[model samples]
Target: MSIHLFQISLTQLQGVGPQKAEELHALGISTVGDLIEYYPFRYEDYRVREMHEIKDGERITIQGTIASLPTMQRFGGKTRLICRVTVESMLVTAVWFNRAFLKEQLTPGREITLTGKWEQRRRQMTVADSEFPDKGGAKTGTLQPVYSVGGSLTQASIRKMINQALIQFGALIPEILPAELLEKHALLPRRSAITRIHRPENTLEGQEARRRMVYEELFLFQLKLQAYRATHMKQADGLVHPVNNEEIRQFVSRLPFELTGSQKQVINEILHDMKQPYVMNRLLQGDVGSGKTVVAAVGLYATVKAGHQGALMVPTEILAEQHTRSLGAMFEPYGIQVGLLTGSLTERKRRDLIASLQMGLLDIVVGTHALIQEDVYFRSLGLVITDEQHRFGVNQRSILRRKGMNPDVLTMTATPIPRTLAITVFGDMDVSTLRERPKGRKPIKTYSVKHNMMDRVLGFIRKEAEQGRQTFFICPLIEESEKLDVQNAIDLHMQLTHALPELAIGLLHGRMNAAEKEATMATYAAGETNVLVSTTVIEVGVDVPNATLMIVMDADRFGLSQLHQLRGRVGRGEHQSFCILIADPKSENGQERMKAMTDTDDGFEISRRDLEIRGPGEFFGTKQSGMPEFRLANLVNDFEVLEQARDDAAALTASESFWSSQSYKELRDNLNRDAKQQTEPLD
Candidate 1:
């Protein structure tokens, strides 16, 4: 019978009551379809093996007959059950801790199988799981799926419920991938994949099932992105602006510094997109000091020269103000009116800025989220640029784009994203990368030290301050947290003030209001504060050329990309800058992160390692970074599969007949449904 598994309630399954249903819902399994798709994170190999064949320290499953009655021993707050089992004619001691109930089944001459780690010295086995041959739920000689359970649900219970759901509704599972696509990729049918993934007879079968799921996930994601691009191009209301090449060239020539080759090429790409019949959707990626701002200014200048307006949205007010000052000075000679609109603006100032934008009096407006306010309107907003694109959600990007008539959008990020993520997360937009740093920028020297070196680090900072340089002391937390052992900005600032009272110290964090943060940053930027103790709030877009020192406390608490970003805050000028990571991390991952910081100053390399260590989920807050959470696909390890899937998705989206054909109706419907469910950006 035909059915929609998604519409069937998980509570309808046997033994799943309201409480259990609520628990499952918390795990993102509310419907029967979600339950079936809830694949296991790993599996247990319980295939029976002979004791003599098993290697020392190897975890193996052995079938045997009970050779002796079980004996129980009580200890301090713990109990142990010991029994002798004859495995392949050899007697081995099986031990189970705190499992007193197992004694009832460990009778003499009873046949059973035990899976555990074997110690050859004592010929003893630490039984992790045991099952009798006559048991109903025996998982012997198979790969048992292990799921990630939460609340009161055990792995056994989850597995049981999944089995029940599959047995009852397996026939209703529809194939999401088209038949031709599946055959081309050699993917299993959806129903078979679901079944084998949950209960595979062997490791190879399980891997094949996992491969199918990974490809399906990546393909579906790419399809949505491609479809979004297609829909936008089809409804293209883009304006074809006349290119004033001479004027733009003159503006570029007027700059004090010469443009690099990469910058010039990227500018050509942006300018070319502007002249196209379709709206330009581009992502500009650059390292922290790679001169992305200059390239963005050129794009904005092109829009203004065409008698249109532009708006740049940043994550923080301080960055917006910094951009306003720098861009305003650069455009002053060119007669371009640039305005700043932030939440900290006074009422009269905000009103006047809004009026100027609406009247086309402002050529380029740089602001925070305040630019997307309801009262703000632009007369001819032709270009929209967002700095630190990962900071904003997809919906926020769409909202800002909606402010204009299908404006050519340019999103910029200083965070060096790996090539794999760049293609998948932003498959909808064209990409422009600037790898070459601006001329004459020095590499920042980095070091990792323990907490005991704080005194020496402080002495070095004092010397730097004496040499007429600034320093930034970054903490992970704004306020003191009892649960965490890391340094807090407030306490660090206080201690530093006492330790180095001679140097002027200032505090900055996210807890402060926008106005206060702006004021604090202004003082630090203007050299009034020689030492600024702040949190990660100053992680991005806070450019201080004279600041030659960066000290990060508890650096292990941060990801590699973040540590790199913090390090990038310095090394902006020609001076020999330094970044000291103060962390005594115990975990191997943390140690690797610290070592990575001291090894290289390359942002791209650090980001690649970050993806490998933290995976894609924590690459940059997956929810906010616009990265989809795939069940079986890994952006780092499964790059090849992802590439193939992307190619197939591109081919499928380019076919107009495929979308309209009756054979592909189900796939089209699924695509539309997925699109409606997500809050994806239009541009």
Candidate 2:
């Protein structure tokens, strides 16, 4: 049961020194266990066949002896190594290009095996691989694993390393999965799966082996997540807030706009969770301009009505100020006091705000991560809400939740999470989605155009500005990067100021201090600036109703999800909005992303395509979002396996037998070990 052997470094291997070990580590193989799990991306079948049975353009292996001495010939800087081999009583020419080193090995009457593409008409084989059979070459007519090797590594060298690992340590791999679970799924044992995956005799064996490994990875991952959910539920007792429907209805009636059906449904779900005995851990998903804030306001209102406080956390100070204004306007009718806290606030003002929160003088408070400061505390923190939830780390969310003893937590995001991630990354929390935008919202018209049409687009912008409408000019960077050819916000702002000298322009980017960002955004929001040139900082919470046009420079530089978010910024107003994407994408994938943006305005569809194109890691901005990088199991292609694993993990985690039985000891140990390594919260 000792894992000491598996924990040994790859440097212990015969030919692996520090440099070679570092290369293996780059492939996620630092230990023997890692080496065994480093499965090949593909396999080649080199079945020895008779020369008569070979067909044109087919890759075949033929065994023969050298009939004539190998000769090197040069023709106009192109070198060829040619030899005639005797195969099945016939002489067939074996050809290799730029392989002068093979001449020393191909001696007359020497026995060798050649594998290459065969051309029936030429009576020749273009040798792709050759082996000296009597000198411990691999057996003919067997499957060979083709690993994805890089940087001073070759296929044969990797094959050799894997073989050495299997021979020395494959059997020592502990079977941590419970026997019952393995039998129920008909999975191969850990040892056999590793061996078959690396050295399968046939395709079916390889596939089955892969299936076992994929399931094992997913099962272990889900076990940790589900265990966290179950353990937390058992340990924490949540506040039960009173739901006053008549009061909520009266508040909704006084609103300026009618709530969409999606909004009302989500409000009901959140309110329903609030009144429950346990704490609310729910995710609110809606596209940009889906009115999630109003629904969230109702929840805060309900909490305040129950004589408890509410807090909303956002990623940016500008968003906090915006939410405070909007929510303050809504809550004023009912005499609910809302306060704002931010890093930019003076020390005296911040102290006063903290004192107000501690004294229970404020009904609701909105702030940036400044809300999670060690000194910040709430007297009766009943419900916790986070806007742009993906921007905050799990630890930050957890810290905010800890401010209240089992407060109902409601997190909101404008980024539409794909279904695969909804089940994996957020499987532990209850989810409410707002698919329909509020009524009277028009679809944003999107276009992908080349740089040559910039003059025409600029003229259109001028006409729009003349009509008293505003524009948002988006750039990928704050300053022009030497490696990237995209326009920058500072230079763009200057250019627009000169070219359209009649219009007022304002620039905003991350490099600006918090007060500067707020002031610049304030000027644009108040109609003092006709164009706001900025980066993605405005992608989330800046809601300008009059801005009707969005011009994104070098649109191909952004991901599909990001492009969708940026597009969401302009279409908030009733005026017919247009999103102009300017770029000349060089890669096919880049071109496809641009095309997908122009084709549809649906956030969910865009997210699905984004998940497929850029994958889960980049889809969620994995580094900041804490999305796990899986090695074998793909959330998109292996969705069925993921679901099965999730269901099984949940069932097992919820079962009393799993907790009480000794048969599950090893599995329990694995779950505990994984829990120790996990820094992200279950939500």
Candidate 3:
């Protein structure tokens, strides 16, 4: 398939000169195909309105006679147009800011239709764009698409280009889906969907078109992910390690506490996967204090008992060191040699560990990214375990796998993601959940307060510290600036140290050097520091069993999932813990978010509710995280369509006879073309 289509040539569009084309290209609209595929983020319903039924901030279309001729006046040397209109005995004022030439478009006593939001001020009604309306009564009651464009590109320009593209190629769109699959799924043909999306005759048709497109995109994406997983599984050569029940039983018996049923279930699942001939690609998802680490440790011990080496890769050096210490204590009693390798270690120490690893003298190795370095070769790496797997990309995981003879992977995450999102994001991996906390862990009491209650919050913190319990004061920013964020780490550190002069205070953030950060965390972990003021860098792996309090300043600035993870830092010990959320936003969503935190402690429930309230993109930090950026589909809002698409794809792929069909070939070619286009350089 060629990159260029008959309608994709922007040079052929009316008013899209080379200069304008370049501007459009910056918005990811280099061709007509791009314009057509750039689906609307939302629709504005302006199809029906009455003069007497006008509400404030309601987008409406109304036709009326001009009560007076539009007049232009100069305000601060900028021209403005002011006019009045009457609709069904209702009078409204219209203002066009800095649009002097618009007055000519509206003549006195001329009947015209206007589409804009109604505003009520001082018992008067006003419309922003009342002076200019399209010719055909503004096509009332239809869904109007809103495109995401750059500041330089106006919505009108996008609408125009899309309309032109549809007119040029709407009838020529080749159907790519298999006919039987489309029929079974009740999906619209490609041509009809594209046409209706660009130029719908009614709201129903527009909705149908959008549903079809969103489903198709989601289905194809899931299919690609599943195919990748299947291909990898078929080609991977894995070592089959039988379960060592005695080793696991010994480790469990030595522990002071008993494992929950959920923990035991997860351990059993891992053992089952290890006994399989194919490699294991699994994710262990659990909430804070769920004892997932111990489960992973048991899995590591089983692999080592089978005479194979395992590597635990963590995102941060602090986490790696913590894991090394915990695992070393457990394995040492059994005569298992465990080595620690991190970037912060001395050159000589790192070299020694690497030599021991290569010589098969080490049974288990734990480190950060240093473990994946080419110089650190494993004797017989069979299992690769990554803590907080979301922190690393797919390529990084692949690099670690290449180090061993196709090692079985077990990635763990404490972030309790919703089921729908987890399936969509990690559809390729087998999933196991540890829903139960340890036997003796206490539930953390949570509270949401306003900024005015700072004195009370500080008093509570002082009381906890006086009891010899550690506390964490988390901030969203590193330094105080002109923004509305709470006090920065430096400012908060100073204020807290001054307030609690008798207590030890420390600071930690991403800006600190590795040594400085490790030292600060070590002091706090060692119980030498009573209070630690820091940022979100501590959200992941700074575990202190003595810490019993978490104070999140300006909680509105952080996402619900992130706040949940931050709250997880505490409540790890037997002592009663508390997560204090201080947020003061006047918006309804802000208030609702604060209330939601106080209402529930379950991370997965919070994640689902957050998706419902703020959408999936915001819940996962999609813009920054660089997950699949869909132009047409919303993962949260269109989940039903996504599922339908997945079913449709599965049905189509299940029939072996369809692979040789013409429709199948066309679909494959179209998918390949779309994949190529999606991956191309932006310019």
Candidate 4:
């Protein structure tokens, strides 16, 4: 009756052999409870209609008498069973391809209810799979649940399995949701919901059952997130040194350029949170070229000025080196020392950097995951900033926190997330977004070109390279994949070399070692490489101001946010930047992305469209992005339910007596499991 019962093996069930059980397990259904909860994707109506009333091309069920004898015929390498049935007075021709066995079941004067698409022009139907109804059965007006099946399982096989389950284990079903909560939400009883979700007696029963399942999934998820938020907020921030307006003014004025209004507003938010008693768990989201680095430096500078150290962790060594150089230029003038520690650094150099940081001589350290190993120590660490935060897992971020006592964490993500997702996923942290681009920055012109236009695009790239500007040729794969039609970096590099032999070409991918990638990036950065062919490895970093053109091959293969990130690689300089997307995708989603990329340069708007097109799971790489997958609840369609559930969870968690209540024991256990199952920094 508890959660463990849900894990009972399907092999123990009747009519299930080892092979069938293995096949079922492949679909994530290895237990009796999982089978019961496997709700239908849609319903097929067996409600027989008049033959004359069946519309053309509509899947219909029609009842008729066998007025004519069934005949067998041979077609092009296939068998066909032909028959004529009289429905009232009209004759309908039914053709079942490769189903000569149906002739034995279709005897003269035998009445049958058939389901297939109607072809009114020829008065015939190519019948789909059909089965005979039971004696005294009247299923012509009922709905039959049609589940999504795979791995040698048919609808009938699932039905037989469920029928056996309902007979054997139906009486033992225990309610997971508390009775009071069920009453408040007007949800169906647990057993009835399970029964109707699989084999509903009518349309209304199925609808009610589905609603309850969705509500249960969403409510539990919300509860887990709320608990995490409460626990996170309880952790006290050890560093609360206040840097007032004068210090902030000095820091901002120290820069060569002026700060944007949005950037100033976000800094105020970060600074206020840092000065609070609790740690500042904040995600600083901004569009590309929106001056996030300056604001982050300001935050770190304030922490360092307060006589504490800081560490800025990035995903790539190239980006970390870039950050070290940029931060050093700004901090050097303020008498603050910045250290660059990466995997590529020599052992002696790394040890020296670590000793300097441990001795309090280094004001801030910028590096990759190399900053979090056992030997790397920081003295009085107050702030930790992670660039391209999503690239690192939640555990990776929290590991840095342990180096210092609840250091204020600031995670920077250039992907502009929609508001709904920010509230749901980042519920544990306060968010500050940089919305406006820096002054004098130009928007990159975008184009969605077909494969045939590559000649013109190649010509343009050559022209740009000849003008002393660089171009990036981005492919989705590192090597050519037979399964994926997208161009690969290795082949594209060769192709570009042959096409533009006068200019130098380079290759970059994630598979390359740190030193190899760094050297390749260095050559491209130094203007020695005119054309850089790479994968999404250069999505976040590899900021080359001279790189003004971006040509993405098979652009339709990427997510919208990824495409936008690739586009951000360019347009970092004063020259007019352009993005050429070469793709001819077959799906509607592909077409939508192509149009979105070519239409405008608004990251926020593009993300909103992306979220609408591909729900939360795909938008954020569900598991990898530190988000849980829902079995029933949809983030887009059930946004209101999600909000309501969050409110309910907050109230439930805050209630003093609810924790000790006997009725909520199962829920408490589930919450604990959910917590341990998915631990995230800003979940």
Candidate RMSDs in order: 4.0, 4.4, 4.5, 4.5
**Per-residue lDDT over 1-683 for candidate 3, one digit per residue giving the tens place of the 0 to 100 score:** 12455346787777778988888778877677776677777766656577667777776777777888887888688976777888778777776677676777778778766676677553233444443344554445566677887867887788887788778756556666667667876878887897788667777888888877877777777666555555566453788998878778888889768899999999989988898888888889998778888998898998898889999989888788788888998888889988888888899998999999998999999988888788988889989998888787666777888888877889999888777777676666778998887888887899988899989998998899888898999998898778565678889999998888998999999888888988998899999999999999888866899999999998888878788899999998889999999887675776877787889888778787888887766666642232476768877777777777766665665566545676578666655556631321100
User: In candidate 3, what residue range of length 10 has the lowest lDDT sum?
Assistant: 674-683
Q: Which candidate has the top score in lDDT?
A: 1
Candidate 1 on 591-611: residue-level lDDT in tens? 999988899888888899988
Runs of candidate 1 exceeding 4 Å displacement = 1-35, 50-58, 64-79, 85-91, 97-112, 131-138, 148-172, 343-352, 393-399, 476-498, 501-529, 556-560, 584-592, 608-627, 673-679
Candidate 2, 503-602: lDDT as tens digits = 8999999989998998999889999999999999988878998899999998888888888889888878778999999988575777999889988999
Ranking by TM-score: 1, 2, 3, 4
| Ten residues in sequence with the least summed lDDT for candidate 2 | 674-683
Lowest summed lDDT over 10 consecutive residues: which window, candidate 1?
Answer: 674-683
TM-score of each: 0.86, 0.85, 0.84, 0.83
Which candidate has the top score in TM-score? 1
Order the candidates by lDDT, highest first.
1, 2, 4, 3
Flag regions of model 2 displaced more than 4 Å: 1-35, 47-70, 74-79, 83-94, 97-126, 131-139, 148-161, 164-186, 346-348, 479-484, 511-523, 526-528, 587-589, 612-615, 620-625, 674-679
In TM-score terms, candidate 3 sits at 0.84
- Model 4 is weakest, by summed lDDT over 10 consecutive residues, at 674-683
Better of 1 and 3 by TM-score: 1
Model 4 per-residue lDDT tens digits across residues 230-265: 766756745786887798898798789899999999
Candidate 1 lDDT at 644 equals 87
